[model samples]
Target: MTRRGVIAAVLGSAVAGHIVLGVVAGGAALTAIRAYAAPPAEPVFPAPARPVSPIVSPRWSTERARNDAGEARTVIAALAPLNGRTVADIGAGEGYYEPPLAHAVGRKGHVIAEDIDAATVTRLARRVRPLANVAARLGRPDDAALAPASVDVVLMVHMYHEIGEPYALLWRLRRSLRVGGRIAIVDADRPSGEHGTPPQLLACELGAIGYARTSSRPLGDGVYLAIFEPRALPDTIRVCR
Candidate 1:
């Protein structure tokens, strides 16, 4: 074959290779652009198996329940200004806090006591029957039973971390609060004592869900209380504590 012919063949092959490279590069760039423009997928969280039957038995001792009730009364007193307004207690176990809150809110105000366990809700219903303003509802893993924007305050006491779907629950709680509403999340420094939620992580999660840490106080003997208010809500018109 002639030298010119060989050179011409080499040039043709080089051009074809460049064309292939250009096509591959263009395809990759288009794929990257499409990926960048697409909206992110929603976060997926695992759902634990629900109990076949609700845990109805009182989890706390009678004396312990009384102590908890007393502590709850103090907290409700601190939230005294929210009187005469609708409120929801998320994870209201055994209806311990409902009676005190019911007394605080009086007849005009309502308390929606919610728990994930149906048996607990039944127990709470019976326990709070004397208080006409208290209503018991079963909450789901991802949602509470309260109406959107219907509550003046939402309270979660020593129960936020036990929720399996914390983010989803927080979103639900956020929607439940009224325009000027407040959310008071009270958890012990050690939730379960042995393997409880770390206070710092709780604060971080609450902050992510638009709660501002307003105040904290030591309850007694290694237990600390933290108060958080919704960042989007208006300032407290009347300071209770």
Candidate 2:
């Protein structure tokens, strides 16, 4: 009868069975969940009211050039040690970060490389299949689709500005973080439309969706690395305009 009731009815039916269809939201028919491992009982937040920047390109730079610049190592150093921990590489376009991260995390550690593009995920899966510890999977624009409390660190490199539904995405992503887990985001100091997210705007958007910035620093070449920990989600999340 009410909005919450409708969402509950839709999600509740899915949890009870293998599939559900025709979820109505925002006066439009949304594709129902084909499968759900364990859907959260928490309410889903509305989409952000702000303008989302476009995804300019898949590969920001070549792996050889980035390695020569020591980009991945520098970024990895900003977060807590990854040895024997689980790390999810969000927006893993070409799987550039997989090798270095796999080495850092050690053999006991695990890496989940995710991309929204199905083809990219398939290619990435094949590329990393040789590595015993890394697995590649397709993700969604509004949801990282990570397992709940399964990851120690979530890494987003040069891809934060491309997320269309920041509010909804972050809200869902927060559930994937383990206790004391942190999110690491690397981007440039510029407008999102220009293929970079300004640090202030980034903070505003993340803060609006219940994340606290732990530390941020410039990582040379006009790029920056910011780390955040999840905080309690507010009753209603505000959009950064």
Deviation in Å, model 1, residue 181 alpha carbon: 1.7
TM-score, prediction 1: 0.68
Can you list the residue pairs that collide in candidate 1? Answer: none
Question: Please, what are the lDDT tens digits per residue for candidate 1 over residues 8-110?
Answer: 9999999999999999989966654432231223334333222122233444337576575567767787777756899898888888778778888888899
State the lDDT at 193 in candidate 1: 29
Off by over 4 Å in 2: 1-44
Q: Superposing every Cα of model 2 onto the true structure, what RMSD results?
A: 13.3
Q: Judging by lDDT against the true structure, name the best candidate.
A: 2
lDDT of 2 by residue, 1-241 (tens): 9999999999888876643332224223211121112234656566655456776666887777898878898888776588999999999987999988898899999999999999888889888988899999898998889988898899999998888887777777877877778889999998887778889889988888678899999888889999987765555677676
- The candidate that wins on TM-score is 2
Tell me the alpha-carbon RMSD of every candidate.
15.9, 13.3
